[model samples]
Target: MRTRGALSASGASVLLLALLVLVPIVVLLAAWQQEQWATWQHLLDTVLWRLVGNTLFLMVGVTAGVLLLGVSLAWCVATLEFPGRRWLQWALLLPMAMPAYVLAFVMVDLLDYAGPIQTFLRQWLPVLPDFSARHPLWVVITLSLVLYPYVYMLARLAFEAQGRAVLEQARILGDTASSAFFRVALPMARPGIAAGLALALMETLADFGAVSIFNFDTFTTAIYKSWYGLFNLQAAAQLASLLLLFVVVALWLERRGRSRARYSEIGGRQTLRSRPRLAWGVTLFAFAVLFLAFLLPVSRLLYWVIDNGLMQVDARFLNLIWRTFLLGTMAAVLVLTLAGWLAWVKRHQPSPSVSVAVRLATLGYALPGSVLAVGIMISFSAVESWLADLGVGIVLVSTLAALLLAYVVRFMAVGFGPVENALQQVRPSLVEAARTLGASSAEVGRRVYVPMMLPGLLTALLLVGIDVMKEMPATLLLRPFGWDTLAVRIYELTAEGEWQRAAAPALTLVLLGLIPVMVLTRRRSARLS
Candidate 1:
């Protein structure tokens, strides 16, 4: 009787946490049907189609570019022997530390009319008239540079896991290196590649900074414009609904592809694959690719930081850095805790209703920051009204609570993935052994599951921490009045054309992001080797 009570209490606690996490989404959907449908219909008639087209085009373009750059680079680093292959393997991931908006700012600073590239061109050519072109292509290129690392990391892991025996067998069967790679290696790496591609697509869809600055109208930007520009929350919600549908489709495709994938080599004499020698011509091509993809944008940021004397080693700036660190760390811990609990339930006690509910809860990740902000506003407003009706005074909107909830909603997936992946790796027999030894399910989970899943939980925390630190649109909208995160500060400065001031915080966020990437890479390398 006591055990049953305890189990019931535990289940209730889990359910309550899940409900709190879902409150804003529930409020948003309820409020949308209450008063905003008409304005949404109007906006849908006017600007919705254009926004949809631009967003779809950008998503497709960025997805293709990231996959190409990421997979090719992974292939080169993993399978081809080169002079700096070892360094390149890790260095390639550095771009991910740099946010898309920061890269966009760097590109604009370098390629604008009065910027370095044009000035250099004028100095050399001296005769070409001042040429100006609104190149959307540059946005695609800059975004790819920063985002391809997602694909690269996954694909490289896939390649590294592909043992030499399979490739050697193919070679012995009269297959040349190129043919072997095409027929055997690439097919085997599909799962990892697809996973990477799914991540890339998600980032591309959720992007606000890069698309906003580049003046390329995507669904995210449209959501922002509708909410802030026209004060049309309903319209924004409608657009968000559409965007959500698109994301659902993409995710479905990715899941389908993943289900069909049979990339894991289950039984084989595993040996490290020998690196293929690069011909001189191919080596030069590889260098050029690396230079254009990874080196140039980074070099630009370094130059601007040095040339403008923007590197601040001051106390006030240090305080901002500390605050940013605290916020990110706390948010990561909170998100991980909630995500771990939810994942645990999904894995152990999943039913159709629970699975559907979990999926619906995670949809917050796909909603635009502006849409989420509006949802939060609607929810908080209702709460405040309820408090007033009960003769109690409470302010809910524009508080730390609201901001944290938004962060949780936006980044739960980051924390969830690592924990789930970690849990999957632990053999089910370990838990079964504990159960057979007279341990309850709760005890088995607490003892056998949590300990083994700590690394994955930590990884998830790191991923969410980095994402929250770099997050802008959501932070900008939902942050308490006068409370500025590093991302918010950077975006404000850059928007005002104060690139020098922006560079400091931008650099700080990048450095913070790099720490986790370095840790993850080291741990991954150690395990693989």
Candidate 2:
């Protein structure tokens, strides 16, 4: 009877989660099917192919740039001890604290002809031509700087964690260092490298802020324009469906790459890998990458804030910060609650249906925020329609509730992944023992599992909070009237080329972003220690 009760509870919880997760996808499909054929034809005739081409171009460019920079820097720092190498180990990650949009604005202003860099350059060399930041090259460069840290972090960890014994064995078999690295170390690290690239590619695909700021059109921007510009939700829904196809393909590639790469952990008590002596060539190269990636953009932000002074942080600014913080907190709390429930269900009762639901729920991480927002609006509009049909005037459309719901759908994966991992780590023996002591499933969770999952729960909260705080496209697409966040403020101000005014909010976002970076750093430190 007790087992049956547990199963019943698990089934109920899993079913609810599955429905909630399915809402957006189902709504998108329904919206697409119900739309006039003219809408799809209009998209096909005009912007669909262009959006696909631009998205693919940016994805390929950014992926290539990130891989080159991330892997090289990872190899350099992991193997060659250089000046400031220890500090570079952590400082390389600072750029991760800045959103791609923030980086976009910084790069645009600093590299502009009227800006200091060009102003000074023209003074010495009158032959230099003025360059526009809107160029596709600049967009790729700006995004690569902020996004490369994702790759760098993962590749560094992978490179450091590799089996040093294998490399040495290859070398002893008359292989050169370079040859051993190419044949042995690189293949073993492919899984981590692939995972990092997958993350970067997803971020690139979902990027509306950077692309919009730079006037680069992609599927994300197209989806937004379809909904707002053309005022056609059906067109938006169809575009989002197309975006999902891109995500599915990327995920399949990532999975295939990972499956083809494997490493065995056969040996125990592995010795620490020694770093080679610092060479000036390597030292300068590391510093150059660090200075370009971290010091330049951050230094520019700090400078503008100081130069702009107190006017930037007036009553309006404080309100923006407060609203942003409150929204992020509420969303994070709600997501954590939903994540905890789903994680518990997956842990307590593993079934095929539950597994599929879990996959569907977490898959949004690969989706662009604009796609998610469009799908969310479709679902929300349906609920509003149903409510009106039932003779009630209350509607979620254009309400704070709608925006928060969108955040939950889009960012639940950000919170859930960590919590699910924590849940997976909890010993089944411990849960079984607790049940043997006459504890109900609920009590067992509260008394035994909750405490154990606290670390991941906290981590999830921080991650979701930071992501919500940084999120732009979804918030822009779904926010209620008069609802403005720091992210939105930054987007608007930066769009108008108001870099000085945007600096304060940008700085705050970066600071709020540091919470996750600090968490990552502390965790890495703990592991190393």
Predicted structure with the largest TM-score when compared to the true one? 2
lDDT of 1 by residue, 274-321 (tens): 445554444565566566654676676666678777544677677667
User: In candidate 1, where is summed lDDT lowest over 10 consecutive residues?
Assistant: 266-275
Q: Where is model 2 more than 4 Å wrong at Cα? A: 34-46, 266-278, 428-451
Q: lDDT per model, in order?
A: 0.75, 0.82
What would the per-residue lDDT of candidate 2 be over residues 1-529, giving only the tens digit for each residue?
3397787777777677667667777777777557468877887798778888888889789988899888888877765656677777887888788899988888788888788888888899969875775889988887888888888888887777764677778999999988988888788778888888888888888888888888898888888787888898888887788888878777887898799776654252245455455456766876777677667877888898899784555788888889999999999999999888888777767788888887777766776778768877877777789999999888787788888877887887899989888888789899899999999989987998888888888899999999999999989998888789999998899879898888889888988999888897887778677
lDDT of predicted model 1: 0.75
| Candidate 2 structure lDDT | 0.82
Instruction: Report the error of model 1 at residue 112, Å.
Output: 0.8
Query: What value does the lDDT take at residue 475 in candidate 1?
Result: 79
What are the models' TM-scores? 0.85, 0.92
TM-score of 1: 0.85
